[model samples]
Target: MEVVRSSIVLSRGRSRLTVTGVLTGLLLTLSVPAALPESGAVTPERGSAYMGMGVLAHDGIARGATADSLPDSRTGQTEGVDVSSYQRDVAWSTLYGSGVRWAYTKATEGTSYKNAYFTQQYTGSYDVGIVRGAYHFATPDSTGGAAQADYFVNHGGGWSADGKTLPGVLDIEWNPYGGDCYGKSKSQMVTWIRDFLNRYKARTGRAAVIYTATNWWTQCTGNYSGFGATNPLWIARYASTPGTLPAGWAYYTMWQYTSTGKTVGDHDRFNGGTTQLKTFASG
Candidate 1:
């Protein structure tokens, strides 16, 4: 720091700059951005994180495509939605009346944040006869996956045998606050994910659904396929088709096809019809 300042001061005379201008410019250039706060600072804010909140923010959304444009996209499929604290009070009855059959609400993030609207979104979905589940937005850089999983399960991410509740989802995608991969290598990422999934199933006696965009998964996990058999895939693609999916999965269990739903929160499609969705919920 001293050497750099000395060099800047030495260049002041040659560059013909005033001392005040030089010092001010140097400090301004070195200052950290206000938008990207330190993790310690930002986590305390307890911000809401919906499914694909990080994915959409970090990964570019597919252009010139809407779910309706694809003729086969909605034919006989069960509809669903995923919400978070951002959704505040969701209209679950309206969604259920409009052909929605299932829902997932954001329950936790990292080991610090829990969605304040989780009870309303989660219980309301159930009350309306929409199969409901909870999701945890993962932040691998902040804490261990198992620890985060425990935090999630403790804070409304737990599954039940009531048949109206689906297994909790692990919303692992792009990191919205910083580097996309959360600073982990492909292998490290797989390990972290494994820890979370294992802990979730062990805790709840059911495998958690894994939600992610294909590009982000490829970049972070090197398209790891080992989890496909145990964890159901919830692929996020804003376009008509799910496009090429992340490795391991033969077919997506759920597709979060549109982030912009008509006032019902982010809409999704269960790859199968209502019966299959019920069976999935029972499991």
Candidate 2:
């Protein structure tokens, strides 16, 4: 359907706007916040960014794990899911009924954006018996690791020994806005991540979980294995198995198996059972 455009265009050094266009623009301006940046330099609506949004956006959805890569068994693994502002007001009760015992909610990004739905997604899951925690989408190009870590914890990523609250996660992956690794060389990238992890540990007394894909960790950090000793790994792979984890760990704590989950959000599997999961959370 073609839009009908029949209006006199105002001519001046200022610009050109049809009489009808003026009314529409006025209404839009009045309703929209002037604070929102009109360019790509700023983060989008609060909570809109989710884990793997960049993975599926910049890297094709088909890039990761394949069906043949699945493990022979997933027996006794705890069901889990991850959510962000992208899935506003998730069906926590529904997910709980479906056996999703754990969840991670996007809490902050860089030093700026914070998930607007942190409360609903974070606390709601807890209320429904889901052990829950928050995550920070790292943007090394935008701020120092310590700053971003501070912002994340201050906003929603803080951890406690409570059995219901899992440690925060550091979502470091392909840069959705630009080059992979946020344009940092392997050494610099590793340094930034160290800053974040150190600050996070100082603040919360728990090493935040490191969430990344094998390819990303290899590419961005040059296959650095230093972090595996301290931080638990939450491996992301759209494939069957978490697929050859980044250089460090012998095992993965949680595996985000698919971005398109069976139920509400991205599906994951805890590598352990109830007691193990609680122990991991408490520590």
Candidate 3:
């Protein structure tokens, strides 16, 4: 839920090409837009940004719980973390030694911006024997979801059957822009998400992991429950426990418990032990 100032232009056609400004030193050119369905007929009042950039920008705010509070290996859970370019030059060895069993690196944002540090972070974590995955920060308002999915898959977000890599993730959280729900109604948001997931699945032969917060999902999507059965849920909550999950998902696969962790970036946990974690990554 970071705010990036992007400049976008829309053209009338089956496909749209966009050139986005450099963000955190990453420049991107996007060319993928299928016929975008109009936003839902009803324009609901905008909701508050769930994980607003302003909140994440201030690290001084008490992060409630730390990685130390998590259940130990005896509890059958595995430790992990997620990073973006904001965590520059990560010490992969240090993280691995610190018991980080896996990692998910931000690869692309919107249709246009690609993370400059994705390659190093992804491969470095893998070389250190950490299960790794790549995620795309979604901007459903910019264009059609199918187009964005195509763009993401073409980039580092593509999935492989290699047992060390987890399937790609879709990070659809609070919008940093003025509108909380990105101006899309409940039904429209669902449609956009479905489009993205369908295309991503078709390309990778696996469902993408969804990274979202409970508040945002409920407010923006009207608590839609369709994706739970197929896509794995990666819930972000800053407390010791995962609290209440969004509708549809009976359980969470991964929980991002804190943004300011003792070891580098956001601390996460796999719902199960090392063996189950490997099985999850193998898909």
Give the winner by TM-score: 1
Off by over 4 Å in 3: 1-74, 261-263
Question: lDDT of each prediction vs. the true structure?
Answer: 0.74, 0.74, 0.70
Per-residue lDDT of 62 in model 3: 28
What does the lDDT read for residue 263 in candidate 3? Answer: 25
Writing each residue's lDDT as its tens digit, candidate 1 over 1-283 gives 1123323421111111221211101210111112222455343143444566555554434666433352234576887878877568997777776677899988889998878888898889888898999989898999999999999999999988877889999999876567779899999999999999999989999999999999999989999999998889999886667899888899999998756422356668898888888888889
| Candidate 1 accuracy as TM-score | 0.81
TM-score of each: 0.81, 0.79, 0.77
Residues 124-162 of candidate 2 have per-residue lDDT tens digits of: 999998999999999899999999999999998999888
How many steric clashes does model 2 contain? 2
Model 1 worst lDDT run, 10 consecutive residues: 24-33
Q: Residue 72, candidate 3: how far off, in angstroms? A: 6.3
Q: Record all residue pairs in model 3 with backbone atoms less than 3 Å apart, i.e. clashing.
A: none
The reply for model 1, stretches above 4 Å from the true place, is 1-46, 66-73, 261-263
Give lDDT for model 2.
0.74
Lowest lDDT sum, 10 consecutive residues, model 2, at 24-33
TM-score of 3: 0.77
